[model samples]
Target: MFDIARQHLKTPRDLLRFAMSRFTEAGLFFGHGTDNAWDEAAYLIAHTLHLPIDRFDALLDARLLPSELNDALDILERRVSERVPAAYLTREAWLAGHDFYIDERVIVPRSFIAELLPDGLSPWIEHPELVHRALDLCTGSGCLAILLADAYPDAEVDAVDLSTDALDVATLNIERYGLEQRVTPIESDLWAGVAGNRYDLIVSNPPYVDAESVAALPDEYLKEPELALGSGEDGLDATRAILEQATHFLNPFGVLVVEIGHNRDVLEALYPALTFTWLDTSGGDGFVFLLTREDLVTGGL
Candidate 1:
């Protein structure tokens, strides 16, 4: 079947169509860098050709040589057989429209928190201008830290992660964006190595996937490091630690923002007294919550 399909795949558009069909037939997951088969197929086709993604309309009709067609088909076949994310296969991912170098060393950057960084945490932050220091916990690929640096140019951002491999990828991205002066990659388990530092804003997209959920995730997700995905039985082990210790690293008026994914109900039940101000993004509820230092001290443990 693939042989017949490959024979007809002579142009970029033809290859895209063939890939989308194969992806759907293989029941592939698309939540890493794209959400659907069409976009994912386009990404694979365009990136394989070394053409810009946005130029799809202009380049769709371009014919592919025999060798190029074989190479593209091979990648598409491996994507279906391996179940690895297209971003890992392509060695790139984008968050908030910003490009970053990615690999198996880190999880593909897909945090919804990226959508909320442009506004500078407004309404939740009374004085956005006063945000001089910010921290990104479990800063995979350093995408969030880079976004924070871009959003708040004057602020110094510290990105921490336990996995040295993931930190290496983050360092590459930090350097790629020319943000070494503003963003520093620190090797630490949460906040252990960065003690005594206070920040006006603390953000995290920690490993909140529970053990059961982690085990049940698609093969594409399994390609990422399990240390960056699972937290404990309830998936709140890392988040619980962050909530307990975040206040110590926060200034008087500091605020904490975190993305717990679908674990919001568990988190809310765990701490019913604390009012978690969930933020809304383009992708609906977002499952991200904001809390002030006062809220953490007075309401949260």
Candidate 2:
């Protein structure tokens, strides 16, 4: 198949079409960064050609050089055979219009919390400049921590993770964004490393995939670190820990925003007394929830 591609797939359009067909035929999963074969193919192809990924229309008919063609086919073949997320192949993930370096060390950055950052957690945060401290638990590649630094310029954002390898990637991204002084990468089990630190805002996109779902995850998802995906049985272990201990880590009027995946019902059922203000994202409101320090202390989770 690759030989045939090499012989016939000369242009970006030919490669794009061939890739989409191959990806679809392979029954590949598309949850990481892209959700369709077209976008995935375009991204891998664009990256292969060293062209702009988002502006592929101009490059479609342009023929790739011999070397670029080989690289494009190689990456496409890997995407089919390896079943790893494309971000793992390309070592890049974009969230909220910002690119972050990513690898198998961390799950691809697809946090609904990312959608909230641009508005600076408006109304709830009230003033982004007033935010002096922020925390991103399960920081993964420190994507959110970098975003937090961008969102709240005055805030010192701490990016915490259990995996040193993940923290290492986060540190690279922090340096990439030139946020080294503002975003501190800490290796800890959630809030363990930052116990004494209080924050005006805390954001997390923790491991929330349930046991059943994790077992049935696609090969692409399986390629990611399991520790970054599954929590306890109901997928609420990390979320529960965050809720129970968040109030102590937050300032008197601080707010907590979390992306719980599909566990809103499970989380709400577990803590019925807590009034979770579901935040709206492109995926919908149920995936993320917000709570104030008052709500946490009052609900007594």
Q: Which candidate leads in lDDT?
A: 2
> Against the true structure, whose TM-score is highest?
2
Give per-residue CA lDDT, model 2, range 1-301, as digits (tens).
Answer: 9888898878999998999899989999998988899999999989878898667898799867889899999999999998989999999899988999998989898988887884836788887887999999999999889988998889899999999999999999999989888999998998889988899999999999999999999899889899999998999999999999998899999999999998888888999999999988889889999999999988985
For residues 1-301, what per-residue lDDT tens digits would candidate 1 score against the true structure?
A: 6678667878888988888888999999989978899999888888888888898879888889988888888888889999989989889888888999999999889887898885747876655567899999999899999999988777999999998999999999999999999999999999898999999999999998988898799999999988889999999999999999988999998989999988888998899888788889666674899999999888846
Clashing pairs in 2: none
**Candidate 1 worst ten-residue window by lDDT:** 120-129
TM-score for each prediction? 0.96, 0.98
Off by over 4 Å in 2: 118-120
For each candidate in the order shown, give its overall lDDT on alpha carbons: 0.89, 0.90
What TM-score does candidate 1 reach? 0.96
